[model samples]
Target: MKYVLFVYGDEKPWADAGAAEREAVYAQWGAYESLLTEHGARRGGNELAASATATTIRKQDGQVLITDGPFAETVEQISGYMVVEAADQAQAVEFAKAQPGEVFLRAVHDYGLDHLAPAEAPPGVRYTLLVYGPGGQETTPEQAAASAQEHYAYIELLLARGAFLDTVALQGLDTAALVRKPGVEVLITHGPFAETVEHLGGYYEIVAKDLDEAIELAKALPEPVVEVRPVVEYSG
Candidate 1:
């Protein structure tokens, strides 16, 4: 099974940390990444730029409104994510428990697009389009199928433009789990990290020349609200 670990935490402390402190944090992350690799759980992951650099898009009154900042205004923000291959939800939860801050574990919903090439664009910067929507809504099978078709069409457009990297839809919050390690104890909850009406539905990873191009591409997505954030690049 594939699971996504959404790492959420306050960015202020990190932003305020000095170089040494930041490096220490990075070292901790390095250790965690190594642990995942040793366990054969790490598929792929990336740390995102600060939420302040995010650009959001939403359609209102028939006009697409482009705004600054993240989609959610909360104390804790999503800092990064990891896609892990695990045996089951239990193993995924165990993986999440070792992560820093609070992690939302969500099972990946197969949309039958796994065979698509991750990317076709030339080497350049990458961005993640965080898709948010009103959760806990009921939909008939026909309606769900129609919605999937629309997304598939949009994805095809992305592929033709050589912008598609990867995409994943998440199962509903009912199957979601929150893993937190405040101190010595690990706390696990069987729901979303937040109680907001707009829950994170999924995300698209894409490559673009720059932020402007990324925003332009994000405007083409079918999601009601899309938060575009740059991916932090590290030289290997």
Candidate 2:
């Protein structure tokens, strides 16, 4: 099981500390992460920016309302998350309780509890691939001619095996968002995700045998870091 630790605390103490102290604290955190990786227990973690910059949104009476602030007002507010892969909840709890910082716990909620159904038809899953450094070079006549035949053949192999759900190479981040309110039809503003990362070059979605199988398939895809999570089928 993979568990998430949500950190909550006031930002004042750290801010009150001097720059050297803050750097030292970061160093300590880095050292702790190193220890976890060395012991083969760490998976991933991130230090999020402060909540003052957050924008909260919600749907109110058919209106998509937006607010500028953290989700709530409180002395202790969630700031970041750390994920750890463990054998079970008990083991995960034991590991988290021993962390140097105060942390709250939540299982990486597998929304697919009902998905334990019999594997009749192959599952319909989705994967997102992010590519970068397109090299900006236009295709030459010879290069284009050579790639056409080989690329078509390679694509045929995937289609023949039912492995290609769908694929698209994106232009840039400007195209990531989809318009939620449709303020402007041609200038629609929206995205599949919030915040931003290095590059969301592309994405893919396919069904596999199981979690492990899904990962195995995802790892083979061409993404620097492919996030793998199962889709929870809607039961009606």
Which candidate's TM-score is highest? 1
Candidate 2 lDDT by residue in tens digits, 47-106: 545566433433336544445545445565445546666676556555555454555454
Per-model TM-score versus the true fold: 0.95, 0.46
lDDT agreement of model 2 with the native: 0.47
User: TM-score of the candidate numbered 2?
Assistant: 0.46
lDDT of 1 by residue, 172-215 (tens): 88879988877788888999978988889999999888999999
lDDT of each: 0.89, 0.47
For candidate 1, the TM-score is: 0.95
Task: Give the clash total for candidate 2.
Answer: 12
Clashing pairs in 1: none
Clash number for every model? 0, 12
